[model samples]
Target: MKVSAEIAGFMKRLGHEFAQPELLVRALTHSSVVSPTRPDNQRLEFLGDRVLGLVMAEALFAADAKASEGQLAPRFNALVRGETCAAVARQIDLGQVLKLGRSEMMSGGRRKEAVLADAMEAVLAAVYLDAGYAKAQAVVLKLWGARLDGVAEDARDAKTALQEWAQANGMPPPVYDETDRSGPDHAPIFHVTVRLADGRSAEARGQGARRSIEQAAAQSLLAQLEALA
Candidate 1:
């Protein structure tokens, strides 16, 4: 199937020209728009997740010469998580090209984190099918870019790291409290504060879930402590 000018432009941003353009079209087709003749991207998303995992694993292994499995695993998770994938999708404007049903489009489906993440993976799968593993790996690396260099810092579980820091410094565990919450029930934004036994504290706000907000708060606190040190 022939792709439109917009999709061709997306391909250029994605850094791979598809020999079978239909794969890319299918990759961008959401389940909300699926029909008997029009396949969706769920299957492609599944395959792409594995492909992404493999590429990340190999890259991390090569990047760090002395890191243990425990060290590498969390970095892998950070790199392959939905948040990171969605971030990559946004970088390439993948959401703008997503084909959604009217209902989904009305609901702002293109901007939904899960939808963008899934479509990013599906697009990877399409590239893999159109060419080969090497080509797909190249695309992933190119898109991921500087993220690979910073994965070590990004991989740390901020809450856990903060707690560990408190312990190492002979302070009690840091405390996290929700300062405020707002927005609709379906999408609440949480404001959280993390305070140490020594009275040092930091605050941060985030959307999606409470745990993520806590993590953000902890990360903020960590940054503050690092600056003081």
Candidate 2:
């Protein structure tokens, strides 16, 4: 299938013009689209996840000579997480070109973090399939610019760090509560509170999964604690 002018412009923004334009088409197709002839991006997303992980792992390994596996592991997780993938997808405006079913479109699937992240991975796989691993690596490195540089510094999980601090100070473990859940079912917003035994607490709002929201709330509390210290 031929790509539309919009997809052509998107390819320009993505920094890679496809030799086989059909790959790009497949990447943008969501499962909800209901195409008998055309396939969704699920398989491509799986491949892209592995490819992205390898690229990030190699990049981290080369960048940090003395970092232990412990240090590099968290950095790798940060780079390959759904939030990071969604950020990259936003950079390329991938949502604008996504092919969703009527229900999904009406529900704002394009703005969902999980959808964007999955599409981003599929696009990476498309690039890899269209050209080669080298080209895909180049694109990933370029798209993920600056994030790679700062990832090492921000690699530590906020919740984990906060827990360690609490344990070291002989305090009980931090508790997380979902204070509020709002918005439509398709795109819910979670208000999570992270409270410590010492009564210092912070709340944060996050969209998407409850786990991510809780993590965000923990991060907010950790930042507050650090600032007070």
Candidate 3:
């Protein structure tokens, strides 16, 4: 099959040309578009996740020689999280190349954070398979860019931070509840509220799974608390 000009342009932005061009096609295909002959990116995404984790771990280790594993752990989590991956995907316009089924397209799958993030991971695996680990590393490092530079300080887990703040004030731990779930199953939006013991609370919306939405709600509450302080 011929690679479309759009895919070609995506390859240019991704900074890696595939030796096995079909892999690029597979990486861009969403599970929603399954067929007997066409494989989706799920397998590739699984492999890419591992590759991303290893790269981030090594980078964090070298960047901060004095940081304890406790410190590095959050940073590592921040780097490989779906939100971060989606952010990087947005930066590179990865959304422009995603291949979704009709139903997914109608639901705005291209713009969904979870979809984009998974596609980004699959793309990384495509690069790894087409070239090698070195090339894949180069693509990831270049794409991640400044995120790696500021990861240490920005990596503070918002949920952890907010919990500590509550405990310091002798309040019970925050409670998070999923207030609502909307959209299709493949691309749900979670609305979560984080409430402190004293009833001060805030809600936030996030795209993807419930855990990330909970984290986002905690972050939102923390920001409001800081503003009041």
Candidate 4:
């Protein structure tokens, strides 16, 4: 385990004191660290994923008392998904906290979306375990509320684009599938399948719901149109 005053500052911004800073550090430590007792983030990644989701779900439910679980569930999944977390992690310089061997560091571990997403999840887990749900919720809200809202706005644009593309080509609008998801609550991976009217399929991933499905749809449409040409 490693600790530094510098890393403490990073945690400070996230608004929690680690009950086990080692876990927090391990969450940031890549597989490439020193050999003797090096620990990677995979295990913490597992815990963080669940913690992240619960917090997001709680936030959604509390914010909108009138929204039924059926209505709120998908939105909850979207906000805490992996791609969104990775994007949020990027925004907060989470990569800088990561500990990698010189080789991994130079090769751009900092820029790998999956790694960043995992670290974010681990940190969120640590937050939940350390400070409990309420404080963890606050940290996440400050970090992600505007971003989730933006994701919703992007959803509207995606469907509009799909519609326009369909009408222009005289083709039927696409269909979307919720294939799979991974990661903890704060960050998950949503796999979407988009099918054309003719039964062709295209798959895509997004940090959140509507965009992920739209990506699937857009990819399918593009592939179908390309084949026709």
The best candidate by TM-score is: 2
Superposition error at 190 for model 4 (Å):
20
Which ranges of candidate 2 are over 4 A from the true structure?
Answer: 169-172, 206-209
Per-residue error for 63 in candidate 1, Å, reads 1.7
lDDT of each: 0.91, 0.91, 0.89, 0.73
Ranking by lDDT: 1, 2, 3, 4
The window of 10 residues in a row where model 1 has the poorest summed lDDT is 148-157
Query: What tens digits encode model 3's per-residue C-alpha lDDT throughout 1-229?
Result: 5788998898899998777899999999999998999999999999999999888888889988999888899899888989899989989898888888998998888888889999999999999999998999999899886989877565778899999999999998899888899987767888999999999998889667777788878888988999999
Task: Give candidate 4 misplaced runs (Cα > 4 Å).
Answer: 34-36, 148-229
lDDT of 3 at 41: 98
Model 3: lDDT equals 0.89
Residue by residue across 1-229, what tens digits does model 1's lDDT show? 7779999999999999999999999999999999999999999999999999999999999998889888999899889988889889999999999999998988778777889999999999999999999999999999996898878744778998999899999999999888899986546789998899989999989786577788888988888888989
| Model 2: pairs clashing at backbone N, Cα or C within 3 Å | none
lDDT of 3 at 29: 95
- Candidate 3, residue 167: how far the Cα is off, in Å: 4.1
What is candidate 4's TM-score against the reference?
Answer: 0.65
Q: Is candidate 2 or candidate 3 better by TM-score?
A: 2
